[model samples]
Target: MTTDSGTRTPIRWGVLATGRIAESFASDLALVDGNELAAVGSRSPEAARTFAERFGGSRAHGSYEELAADPDVDVIYVATPHSRHLEDVMMCFEAGKAVLCEKALTMNLADAEKLVAEARSRGLFFAEAMWMRANPNIRRIAELSADGTLGTIGQVRAQLGFVGPAATARLWDPMLGASGLLDVGIYPLTFAHLILGEPVSITAGGTLSDQGIDVNGGATMTYASGAVASIAWTQVAHSDNRASVAGDVGLIEVPARFHHPTMFTHWHDDQLDTISEPVTGRGYAHEIEEVAACLRAGKTESALLPLDDTVAIMGQIETILDQLGVAAR
Candidate 1:
């Protein structure tokens, strides 16, 4: 972000996949001022070229490795599936590239830890792409909760669900590390974590598919502060995607699709206040901006989306799946 002549330099970004998430991130990347989608990479050459053409990338690589190795790309966004995150991100690190990888960090907690260790050992910039944490509204909620504005938080409730296509391999396939919990549940879980740290105990139950992936599930966690969190996620039906945090003095509610909320309401002292935060395109831009800021500051990790919390959440996901009897692959 510094300049010899006093003009800010754009951070050049490379996207490592051509999936829907990649396109969304690219769209938001364009919305930011000092960032550009410099390159795109996909296993299929045509896919890479087509994505670059649509997203305004100047270069397209036929493989993820090639993209990681591209000298012009300052940071690479690993947008591959959850199962491929560890491998893909490690490749980028080996190529001496900073990385912002899509969430679920990896298939399990161990792999997530491996990534953290590798990134730390190499002193490279790395972070999980948990866009929700970077949302202005979500960050505001966390601030209120942390600063005692919510007043002795005692409970948090959240749920996310949709009747997704049963035939969609990404939703039903175990090989792809697909599950309602990993795909959507992590949001509610993380919301709770941001308010109440790690839980002392977690009790969970849910339905599992014939393919051994979770179709629907919920958990109730008890924190050391005596706060309790209840969270649920499902791909089996359309459930209210809302979230609420309750404390002794007040309550805050995030409307449907809380993960990318633009506004939320708080109630206390017989007063209801609505707060609105301007979200950059689709809300992915905040995380992108966070990554760029971290790189410019020479920080290896994002404070908003820390690697330790990511690993802990992955552990929570693994424990929840085990309780649901989803039989890990």
Candidate 2:
């Protein structure tokens, strides 16, 4: 077991993409005390150089291999599209470097399992950057639910959706592994998983594009405890993005973006109560700190976003896709 050391030594990071998500992660890492943006790699040297200059990092390389081979980098952040996560993370793993991969861990369950197995076999840190799982608000929800504040948790309903224009955009692009389900559905699925655990029975239906990705979908999950959750996600319509948990005695409703909600409401037998909290920096810093903490302690995975849970969530997504007749290639 790895223990937290009082002496804080910065964990050097090698950024593996120059996309918006990568930039967001870099900005968030700046707010963490014990993380260093050691290097950056991009398909284009000019892009990598420009990103490095803007982010205040010295080593910018043109190829992923160069960045992965850098001995000074303690970990690599795989910020590429969902389809590339397997290749990017596997490269880093083969190079003997730890990885902090972006969410939707891979295109599918098989690749995700391979990455997890490799990390476990090598005793290196690996985590899906499901930042919401590390948020204070979500943590509080978990604590309250576990403590029985919701009273036997009978049902959960969550939706995350946004309107997108066409197949040209990343959200609609099949080559990029972009779709409503994988891009935004993970939020609701993860939220349900947090409160209800893995579902015993999963049923889903959706509309898929000619390109073969889910454009809009809804999943119904029934847990062994008789708790049921309904989750919906879409790129063609805008949704409330709210989540609710109803129990025998009371209910709780989370505000928009429930996964990273700004406030939540609790109703116990007609008395209504609302709890609000502020979060720091785009809210990605918390997960960055978590990865750093886990890596520094020599841990192979995060307690908040365990590998098994990630795999299970991906499997659920796979089932949903199977039911929808959409393949995530």
Candidate 3:
């Protein structure tokens, strides 16, 4: 079930970084048929070798350059940090490889726009790896919301927070584009946007760290139709991590850990209906499928996880952080 050019053939995935997220992606990719882990590249030779051995990659390259130029690799998964995404993705695209970069696709909107434009000009398939967007339950919920299952959508609320180790590099480092707003808060923001579309007006305010990183923050977005969304996120303390969509007729409640929730409740007046959905293979496979499907079909972007949506999401993050007086570096 492969083609001559190889890019349209069964996917041979190359990972650009040997990080925790990269390892998770490779683990889930194994569940996908018609796909193979071709290679892994890392700045550290040992890290690349170790990742390939564990993740079933056939070859390990000590440098990213080698992986990018690999003819055997049809696509490269850029699993670097928020700050490094643009640089890493560009490397793959310059080498003519399709890319699936992780969420918070870039540090700011400017970089996101550049990446999108580059992908288009190069005629390469590109997608932001926002796995939640690919979830079946989330998709169903989006459909219901659009079809008026919840009536006139008035207000949506979502929050995600957890305790993190103080010494973790990503959490404490400003250069890594560290922000509670970008890292975890983007989930609440995107969840609202997916259901409600872009907001007409955005007003946000929150506290930032002494080092100028957003540790805890909140945002309020209003649509032209009078609907509103309230979002919250923090790494300083533990919260319920809940979400709800309220409308004139009813509301849908996504319980704890709403971003990756498995169950949700539909409330219509006195009636409460609980719906549960099963997930497949750590929830990463769905996003992978979207990428693989696009590449196979000669598509340059995914309808489910479009680059425009990714860029818009980052723009929203910039607006919120700016109003909150937090410098999004």
Candidate 4:
């Protein structure tokens, strides 16, 4: 099922939505080698046509089902909202297509697990589009932490937030499974987990919108290593969007918008070291490249963005939501 080393066929990609994120992904897709934007899908034929035309896509489908069934496409990127992820992804699985789904994976942990089960059973390649894990600098940070450069990490702090756009129903509508934690908090939570393992307990507090969705929140997670992480997310205000990991030996600081950082600083022995790495097209290209490589290698999952970690993050999000009394639909 794997391609020979000498084979160099480009991986054909179909996008399953025409929203803003899909546009960004399409734009980034061009920056990576060995991939093509082969097709696009939208509920409206006109919308699909517009996207395909703009992105140089060969085909435009009026519905997701058509895109899923496109024989030319080797993989489909599911860019739909959190609520539609399970349904949209399952459609791709049935059509025997590899999938790279947008993160949070789904609205809840149960749905995330179901997606994992389906993909594993079908022997299809799948990964959460947790682009941060694919980021070169973030990967380096993990390596430095693991290699004893930052020994015995004892704390991590990360936060991401922006004033939610009032006009966008996707961010304010509870029916869309809109919550700041799902939208912004997942980054900080994942960053914490990247440096430290899963936490033993989580204590959280937040504010809910009139529509009964979380608007702002913060959580403190305590791990078995006696390490603690403080993470925050919000849709009501602008946060610094910074992150850091502290250890007994040193500290590493990722600048604002740390989730997809291209550079960070390492502090040790009364000196500071700045680390920088190349990032392709807003950092999304790395994840795209990862999927293409997995398919070519005949792998069903990516070690960088493992499904178990994705599910665990979803569980953490669910617990935070529950404690904040944000009813799950």
Name model 2 segments beyond 4 Å from true. 1-7
Model 1: weakest 10-residue lDDT segment is 166-175
Predicted candidate 3 versus true structure: per-residue lDDT over 1-329, tens digit per residue = 36676543568899999888898899999998778899999999999999999999999999998999999998889888888988889989999998988888998889999999999999999998899899877887788789988899999999999876887879868988788987899999999999888999998878888898888888889999899999999989897899888888988989888887687889887899988787778888888888888887889999999788888899999899889887646
Q: Is candidate 3 or candidate 4 better by lDDT?
A: 4
Give each model a TM-score: 0.98, 0.95, 0.96, 0.98
Predicted candidate 2 versus true structure: per-residue lDDT over 113-199, tens digit per residue? 888999999988899999999888888877777788778999999999988866446787788888788899999999999999999
> Candidate 3, which segments miss by more than 4 Å at Cα?
1-9
- Prediction 3 global C-alpha lDDT: 0.88
lDDT of 4 at 174: 80
lDDT of 1 at 130: 93
Candidate 1 C-alpha lDDT tens digits along 68-91: 999999999999889899889999
RMSD list, candidates in order: 0.9, 2.3, 2.0, 1.4
Query: Clash number for every model?
Result: 0, 0, 0, 0
Residues 100-152, model 4: lDDT tens digits: 99977999999999999999999999999999999999999999988988888
